[model samples]
Target: MKTMTELMESNIKKNYVFSFLMNFRLSNGLWMIYMASRGMSLTQIGFLEGIFHVTSLMMEVPTGSVADLFGRKLSRSIGRCLSLVSILVLIGATSFFHFTIFMVLAALSYNLESGSGEALVYDSLKYLKAENNFISVLGRQEAIFQVSSVVALLIGGFLGTYSYHYAFWASSGIIAFSVVYSLSFTEPPILESVGRNSKTFRGFLKQIVDSFSLIARDRKVAFLIFFVQTILAFSACIFFYIQNYWKGLGRTEFQIGIYLAAGSFLAGLVAMKVQRLSHLLKEKKVLIILPLISVASMWGVALCSNKLPFFMVVAMIEAMLFVAGNDYINKLIPSRSRATIISFASMMYSLVMIIFFPIFGRIADTISFGVAFVSLAVMASCLYVLSMYLLKKIG
Candidate 1:
């Protein structure tokens, strides 16, 4: 029989392995290009992405609730299975309806892990009495994600030059490893001890109410969730759409891959330093700096002739905030409601994406990428000002 220390170590290490496998999504960087190749307009692609966020918005919380009430291991295993299925569907999809199905499946896969995985890792660390290390651990996870992204984008871009199907096929194979790793995870005692009664449907609803009620009452947690997710939504909008924009500029698959891979590499480096940076800058300064970075990057992408520098900066900012913000919010949430509340935070990202993605896509289709970027800059700046105001009021 394994000791508690052994079990806790197993859970944490296994989660890293599972995360590495799941995020090694070879088709991620080129999926937009693949859809465009299928004779879908950028506007059509935008709507498809909108469908994804809508599904995520609906499913994120429920799936997270299941993870909290049931087991993170089971939730993760199911999500990996769904991810494999989604990739298979993407491989054969031709029509918009087929793509819609793929998007929904993909979104559900994302929703399942969006909060469950974080909660699992955190609670596992908590079991080890290493909860204070969560931010540093989160940084390592982000670094792992970028490492996977670097390899996937390089190979997927190469495969995409020949056939997008090949890239997606490789993605499916990678997700199978995720499934196997997820099943090997030992559930943290934290959830079972605190969440035993929250397994029923009524219990689930109560969990939701209590979680949101906590958020509603906690200004700092609410601010962290909204501020982080809102900026993240903006960053994601740029990253995906930039794939199309770069293609429109006549960049080859290999070159586009290099561009994205470079950003991922830089982000990975930044992610590893998130804890150090946070400590150095202090919390308030870090918060102020991140929004300014977002605002400047957007405008740079819009106005400057060279956008790659700005693009790469956005990637680093994203990695930094994701690690730091998750640590902050998770510190505030109780164990029983942790997954659900974090999922609610994730749902905010989906909500913002659903609203902004289609609008930006329409603008890009009708106007120009420059104008679309400018629009994002303006929106980000306004949000920053409002966020600062709110922060000041809370202070």
Candidate 2:
């Protein structure tokens, strides 16, 4: 048997490799900008966003189940391959139709990776009886993931200034490394041995149903899932448009890159401190209050004449949604359906994104960013009230 130190060292290596690869997309900070630059309308961009989520909503649960049954290492390898192709397609895409098609493929790539890595690391720790480290380790992994994104955002901006093609090409090259890493990455022997417990299709379907039943019966789980899905989905759609919003504010491409990099740095720092914050506030209050803070910051963006508050709030949103909230949920869930249940939350977010992204896009096109954001704030406020009822029950 491997020593705990040995397993942890391997796990951290996999974590950084995958984390870096995941955020290394060259189109990330500039995608909506690139699409718009090609003469696509705001609504068109929104429609593509909706399509991406539709793809993800369809695939999230099944791919997650596959990870649970087969092993994260194999599932992640498949995801990395799809992600690589998706970026290549985007790099070569010349028309709106091509972009849409490539985005659908990219959605598939995200699903394959979504719950797989977290499941791998968490289960590996469980097997090693080192569950205590899961939160801090996961938090650290989550935090630095954004650090890589700062690199991607800067790279995308720098290359995109000359030509978007350069950025796209560079992103694909970075992901090539991740693809190799994924294939070579080892699953914990315990997880590899789980294939023996793999279920038939019928059994898998039953497990999904039972998982939904668990959600239905457990108000805390259901609420947490609902709360995270709603706010994250809303904020994600909002964040995507912020690139254009910056353009509207008279910022140049390079200036936008600097803003993104600065915000990302703050987000990384906040994510690293998530465990400490959780300890200070406690998880229940964290869930309760952070969402409120997130909503307020989002609304503050709409209300502010200056964009600095929006940038600060954007950092908070990233830290809260991606890093803090996710680790908190991980702590609550049992191992057996961990990936499946997390995917369910993710799937729900995809569904919400599908429904609302286009609507918000149209609003931004027809009206203004401020008006669209105000609408989001109203929706978020109502949801926050409802979430409080559920958050109280979690503990």
Candidate 3:
């Protein structure tokens, strides 16, 4: 086994670039959601988030094909550049229309990134004869990414307390650094064989079709994708409801930031240990347990009236299970079409969210936050059972 230090030295530049981009992107995650909520009505916030999902859904296949054809490195660079531009727009924007434009731009950038970066990293590892270690490497990368998220959340929250645009401005600067890093990235030679034919628009479409067809042909992949969609939908509801939940607890945006940071920090720590955990627990078993734990955590969120204990438990659950679940999903995916498959899976997830977020938000707005959360928990619990059964039958 490669020591962590050895892995870092061998892939220093690539890993650093990935870390920078993740830091830039995730640092603003909580802040952006907070801003959208503060700037607009809950309904509008839902709409904006839905738009982000819709844009990603629309772009998923095309962008996946772009990574497939043009090479993941090139596609990732373009995505990072677009992300930087989006952050800049968010910094300058004030009006609802302007915010919408920024949201759309940001969504575009995220859609471009959905799978390209991981594909590039996987391809690079293959070149280095470390393909067999992809799961552990990916887990490590996720840990780094989550650490960046924790840092970014802390900083962004502080800035957001002053002004949301302050957070946006800081995010823009981070994205600029990410863009620079991405531009310097070199594609691994293994990708060259896959890039034999010069790519055309028509070829890109065909590749998209082929990727989707391949996914459909594999029962395991199809079931996993649907399972991922269900899990993400529940996850989305919890995250989306957090702002409102914190408000009920009389927490300031800064305090909420602290809570978000705590969760992410824990997630980072757990992500680092995922490979070891996977060795002890089968991936399918982990998947089932993770979502169940997530459901229980959300139920705890629904029940808690206090702040510190609420946040602590939430962070613990997220770190121990949620991050581990994500790492397992990454491990299950095949290297050759990892990005495209991930993108396709994400697109389906977004499609589900695009429909569900609005309804869930409206329910939170009209009925009760607790009601929406509990409903999600119940649905997630059911999905966990279903996923376990499916995986068992398939295996």
Candidate 4:
């Protein structure tokens, strides 16, 4: 048997590689600019994003189930390959229709990774009887990759200064490497694999159905799922508009890069401590308190004109949302359908994004980014009340 040290060492190595590979997204930092450069307007961009999230929502469960049935390693490899191809297409894409196709494929790639990656890491930890470390490990890996993406974000911007193709080509090469690495990852033996047969298909459907039933029936899990979706949607709207929000306030074009880079660093720095925070505060408190941070952050964004308050609040709230939500939800599901359950969570956020993106985009265009920012804060505040009430009653 592998000793605990050996198991941990191996797992950490694999996890590190997995973490960096998962963040191999170069186009992320500049997608808005790239599409804008292609002559797409704000409405068109929002519509394309809506389409991407809708596609991701549709695919999340099936792909998560695919990972559970086949292997997360394979699922992850497929995601990276798809992302690589999507970036390649994006590089060659010159028209609105081409960009729409790119969004479809990119969204598919995101769904493939969303749940499978988390499930893979959690299961790997569980197999080694190191479940207690899952939160810590997850937090650390997110921290690492968030920092890596920070670097990629900067590089992507620099490349975009020359040509958007430079950014896309660089992104594609990174994703190709990630695909190779994911293909090499060994699946944990604890996962039950499905084979080609009607019987296996029936069993797969049953498992998915059971997972859905459990989430629906369990009030707390259901609340957590939806709460995460809403909070993330709030973040998504605020985040996507922050660059312009700052520019509207008379900040330099140079400061925008700093804000983006700072946000990533602060996100990583805060996320690294999520495990410790979760252990210290417990889930109930986390559920109750995280939203207060979101509320405060949103208010800060709406009210504060200075850079530090805005950026710091944005960073902290985002870090808290991701880490706390995952810490709670990961412990609530069975490993047999863990990926699918998480995908359901991902789907919630996608659904929220699909519904809200255009509305917020229009609001930002018609009224002001500040008004839209405050509006999302109010929505988040309402969600917070619901979260506290539900958790208080059942938790």
Candidate 5:
């Protein structure tokens, strides 16, 4: 049998490219929000983000089923190309409408990514007879991705200081690099059986319906999906608020970059150890406990008077919980319909956020950012309790 290290080495080139692209993509996650704040009102920024979320929600199921029926490599390549185009459009965008167009494209790209790339990697490993090491390998890959985000965010902050457009251009270039890397990849044979029947659009629809029916019938799966959606919605709220909070701390762009980089770097480190963590805790328990910890940490940050403590607490919580939660969700999802399930869950979460984010942003503007944080924390706390009840009921 091929050892895990040997199998990983066999595909190191493709894996590195995928990890780099992920890092490049996430690097701008925070900076983009900060940029939107500069040229628009907070409500407008929230609305634009909501539009992105809406588009992603619409595209998720279709793109996910495409990956399942076609091939992961093809889906990933198309997604990367779409991402490149979106970045180029973002670079040229000057108005809210223009930003909306770019957001739509970006959302579509994210939908394509929902299941394709990671699924390809998983299938590739299985072909190599290294499926047993999926969690560890995935964790390692995520760690690289986080490191890339830290670098990208740092550079993006510096670039944003000069011009926000520069950051978009840089992202475009990075995505192009990803495209080249993706083209060089060879799809594994393990996925050959998956796409045996050439699925028509109607067939795809049937698959989607069947997937939903499965979720509904499997109470464990349905509750897990709901639990994950709640966690993601709260996470989005925290991400949306944190930029404004950092500004309130009298921090510069460089300072903001440093804080983000520190947190992401730590998170990346933790992600590498996720497999070990899995050995110690059940995936469901880890999911619940980590988010609860995140809520408490957010409350601490919101209540803190000092910047140092606020930054430290926020970074620690984010780094520890985000990876743990994601890994847990990954475990719960079935590989056969991974993308579709993930997209379905993401769509539900985004739908919730689309309704609430604008309201929350307006409240933050009229009242206080602290109130926004506190309210979200309270909601997350309630959701955690509900998640526990669901887990028990389902079991």
Candidate 6:
């Protein structure tokens, strides 16, 4: 049998493989275009995205608590299973209702993995006495995500032009494999001590209450969650809707895939360099500047004829924050309820996406994608100012 340290090292490697396999979402780059081809408008697609986030907002915390109480490995494996189911549903989807079903399942799948996976990796590192190296590991993980995304998007885009069904089917196969791969992950031993003591119903409720109470006491944690997640929501909006904008410009699916893959490649490079960049820039300064950069990217994408540069920059910034911001937030919380609190952060992101994504879609449907992006930029700027004001007031 391997020692604890050896076990942890194995967990880290398995996690990287799991994350890579999970992100092979070939359907992502073509979902909107496929729905459009199926006679759904952008507004309808946006509404579907809203449904996803609404489900995530509702289930994120509970799923995170499940990971905290039961086991992170279990949570991750179940998530992959649900994702596989969602993809299967998506392939057969025709009407709005069918799409909504798949979206809800996908959101539930995300809720399970969102916090559990990160917390699992962090705890594994802690066991190895390398918790401090989490950001570096997370950076590499994000880089792997980008690399897989580039490959998946390229293939998906080419296949989707022939038949969206092919892309969905390809994604389903990858997710099915991930479901099995995720099961090979071992639960960190730290969880035995960190999980709630009593296995009763009340213990579950207290675990949740205590997690929320921690957030209530730590204003900085609360602020960090809100600030980082809100920015993430805006960045994700740009990433998805930009496909529509490119399609309107008469770009082929393959060409658009290449464009998105380039952005992902650059983002991967930035993710890999996050540790060095954070050392040079200071994490505090990076956090402060990130929102500003996101705002500029949104505006540039909205107004400029050449939008690729802005898109790539936004992708890079998003990847950087995933590494740095999570490291900062995770340090402020305990392992016992770490997944739950992180889920709260994701819930905040979903809440923002739920409110804004549909509205942005409607605006695009009514006017133009450019105008919708301009609105996003304006909203992001106002939110940034508000977050700063709140930070100062709280400080």
Please name the candidate that would achieve the greatest lDDT relative to the true structure.
Answer: 6
Write the residue-wise lDDT of candidate 1 on 233-300 in tens digits. Answer: 99999999999999999998878999999999999999989899889998888889987887898889
Per-residue accuracy of model 6 over 204-297 as CA lDDT, tens digit each: 7887888899999999899889999999899999999999889999999988999899988888998988888788988667777877887888
Error at 167, model 1, angstroms? 0.7
- Candidate 1: residue 169 lDDT (0-100): 88
Per-residue lDDT tens digits of candidate 4, residues 184-211? 5567655444435513878678767877
lDDT of 2 by residue, 264-318 (tens): 7778778777778888998777887778788788778778777666756767565
Model 2 residue pairs with clashes:
none
The reply for model 2, stretches above 4 Å from the true place, is 1-5, 189-199, 393-395
Candidate 1 runs further than 4 Å off: 191-196
Note each model's CA RMSD in angstroms. Answer: 1.2, 2.2, 3.7, 2.5, 3.2, 1.4
Error of 2 at 40 (Å): 1.3
> 2 or 3, which is superior by lDDT?
2
- Weakest 10 consecutive residues, lDDT, candidate 4? 190-199
For residues 28-122, could you state the per-residue lDDT of candidate 3 as single tens digits? Answer: 54544555555766667677778888888999878877776667778877888887887777666666677678778877777677778767666
Please say which candidate is ahead in TM-score: 2 or 4: 2
Evaluated at residue 98, the lDDT of candidate 1 is: 94
lDDT value, residue 201 of candidate 4: 74
Report the candidate with higher lDDT, 5 versus 6.
Answer: 6
* Alpha-carbon runs more than 4 Å astray in model 3: 1-13, 25-39, 191-198, 307-336
lDDT by candidate, in order shown: 0.89, 0.79, 0.68, 0.77, 0.70, 0.90
**Count of clashing pairs, candidate 1:** 0
> lDDT: which is higher, 2 or 6?
6
lDDT of model 2, residue 10: 81
Report the number of clashing residue pairs per model. 0, 0, 0, 0, 0, 0
Candidate 4 lDDT (Cα, 0 to 1): 0.77
